[model samples]
Every structure is written in C-alpha cells, then in structure tokens.
Target: MNPVIPRLARLFLIAFAGVVALIVVVQIVWINPGKRCEEAGNWWDWRGRACARPVLISDITGRVIDTPEARAAAKDHAASQKAAASKAAPEAVKP
Candidate 1:
C-alpha cells in the first residue's frame, strides 16, 4: 500500500467539499433572497440587503409619480408615447 497515494486522495476530497460548501452558502445568503424580493414585485437592494418599492417613471418627465393621480397621469403618458412610436414607425419605412 502506498501512503502518498492515500494522502493525495484525502486532500482532493477536502478541497472538493470546501468548494461545494461555498456555493451553498452563497445561494442561501444572497441569490435566494434577491430572487424572492423581485418575485414579490419589489426591488432588491444588494448593498443594503433589503427590498424596496420600485421607482415609477413617465418617459423623460421629471414629475413625481407616487400619488393615485400621478400614477394615472403616468399611465396616460406611457400610452401617448406608445401611440407616437407606432405612428413614427410607418413613416420611417417609406421607400
């Protein structure tokens, strides 16, 4: 029986186990939480390790879109932008 062969085999097994443990820890601590946050319709703040509401936007307009009225306005603004884009697309395709 060769002693050197057994020692090398043991070292390889230890290194492989360490790598697997590291992967499991990362999945539990970081990956899973971020996925759950997004699935719940919230933003995952990686630096803060917390979930937050997403910021609403209405094209290039700088108005705050937080209230019910503002949200309705944002929805209208988005529809108008979509209509404008569709109208412009046909003009650009003319030969």
Candidate 2:
C-alpha cells in the first residue's frame, strides 16, 4: 500500500509536467493577431487585413455626406463629450 501511493504520485507529477511543458511550447509558437490592424487604424479581418467597422462604412466610402464640415462637427462633438465627462467626475489629486 505504501509503495502504491508513491507510484501514483510519480505518475501524477509526470502528467502535470507534460501539460506544463506543452503550455510553454504553445506560448512560444503563438502568433499574436491584430497588431497590423491596430497600426492601420482598423479592425482585424479574418483574412488578416484591416477593415473598417460596418457602422463606419459610409465614412470609408467617401460619401457626399461625409465632408470636411461633417468631420469638424464630429471632432467638436467628441471634445464636448469629453468636457462634460470631466466636469461630472472631477479627479481628486494628492500633491
């Protein structure tokens, strides 16, 4: 009975080590996706290409409605949203 316990423990340890080694090997070989897509300022498509979100399809298409004025308006709207958020949550700074 005493010898059986040690043999079982040894088998369990070997199996655990094998699993750990497999995990390390997989991590070394893993290729991270979406780095190129981030650089291109778009989402990573399945074909490894950068693609605009469906909601922004019209903007990407350069439609007549998407003019410089519209872009400026969008920028101004974003700035106002940020300002409002900051005002709502004033951070407490310790100097």
Which number leads on TM-score? 1
lDDT of 1 by residue, 2-42 (tens): 89999999999999999999999989888899999999999
Error of 1 at 48 (Å): 3.5
Off by over 4 Å in 1: 55-73, 76-95
Worst window of 10 by summed lDDT in candidate 1 = 56-65
What TM-score quantifies how close candidate 1 is to the native fold? 0.56
| Residue 21 CA displacement from its true place in model 2, Å | 3.9
Candidate 1: Cα lDDT at 25? 90
Cα lDDT computed for each candidate against the true fold: 0.89, 0.69
Write down the lDDT that model 2 would get: 0.69
Candidate 2 TM-score, true structure as reference: 0.38
lDDT of 2 at 29: 41
